[model samples]
Target: MDEAIIVDAEFVAPVGTTAGEFVPIDRAPAAGLLLLVAFVVLYAKVISKLGKPAIQEFLWEIITRIVPSKQLRRRKEAQLRAIEVHTQRSNTSSQDQFAKWAKLDREYGKLKVEIEDINNSLTASKARFFTIISSAIFLSTTGMKMFLRIKHRKAAIFWLPKNAFPYPIEYILSFSSAPLGSVSVSAWLMICDAAMDLIVTIFVALVVGVIGMLRSNKVKPKTA
Candidate 1:
């Protein structure tokens, strides 16, 4: 009988992989999702900080530049200039020139009404434009997020150790048919968004605190 040789070999997990679990070879999708969630969270924070009116005004300016209604704007400007000229003429004319002054005042009134109409038209157009753009943006972002979640519904970002948490907590992490003890796409997205929001809040608080301290120091009186 031939003697069998047994060699003891220690098992080593691949670098960047857990000891017992096999990690996905391509982590791009998970990583990209994380980055996307973080960016969205950060952008929301920035928009809140800037204030909605400020952002709306900024967007409106951009829209005006891109979709210029030069003719309407020019007409409004000319009407305003004519109104100014009529006021100057009326002011200089004496009671002896009552007819001329009255004619100028009537022209001014017509110009005012025309300008008001132009303003209303412009406001209505802006409202419609903003509505369309906002709807498109909301739909695109929501659709993309839904697609990603559905595509990666069963995929685990990473696995937790068995019994890492209580049953309820584990179930929550493995939500929507994901395997137990693993974080699903939806869970990971929520985690990333929460983490990013926390980080941004902390950073803003730190910056504000530093600025306050510097301002206080600048105004403080030095004791001899």
Candidate 2:
């Protein structure tokens, strides 16, 4: 019986080119990874600024506008108005007006039930709106990352110095079947993402500090 030998092939540049040589075509993968990192970071910052509630509310408003929930909203408002009117009428009525007071109380109870129904419907609609938006965002980000990873699986984003790190670290950095001492798509993406996040954090902190200083200066009493 003949043994089958498995040969692992490394990525090779064009003829006469070295493994880690800088080629003009290498810029595409590097730029793509950088753009992805920047986009992710910017998206995170925007989402943080808006907050989950604000995003959900924004989507809900758009959904309501498109679906014309105005009728339900108007009904809810009318119910509230009716309830208020009943309360006032009951308050001004005398004890001898027992029948009228009873009718007003019954009408108020019905109005409360109607308003509760409208509120429940709106809540469900808002939840669905947010769910759709969240799902779309998740799919888009994940899909882009996966597509890039597969497309550039064997492409070196950039080359590092020879023996830049120990063998173990180099192996890790060259993940997804990339050459040693070369930054692969996955590794470059991680680096870019971390660096971008750090920069964003520092920028936000500086902005907050500057705003704080301006507010303190404005509120500070002038020295006599």
lDDT of each: 0.68, 0.69
Residue runs of model 1 more than 4 Å from their true location after superposition: 1-29, 48-52, 92-94, 140-144, 202-224
- The C-alpha local distance difference test score for the whole of candidate 1 amounts to 0.68
TM-score of each: 0.66, 0.65
By summed lDDT, which 10 consecutive residues of candidate 2 come out lowest?
1-10
Query: What does candidate 2's lDDT look like per residue over 65-112, in tens digits?
Result: 788677577776867788686867668665878777777777777777
> How many Å off is the CA of 125 in candidate 1?
1.3
Q: Write the per-residue lDDT of candidate 1 for residues 1-224, one digit (tens) a residue.
A: 13322222323345555434643333224566556655655665655454556656778888777886874786668687777867677576658787777777777777777777777888898788777766655554555557657887887667776556899998999797677777777887678667667777787788779999999999999999
Backbone steric clashes in candidate 1, count: 0
lDDT of 2: 0.69
Instruction: For each candidate in turn, give its C-alpha RMSD to the true structure in angstroms.
Output: 8.3, 8.0
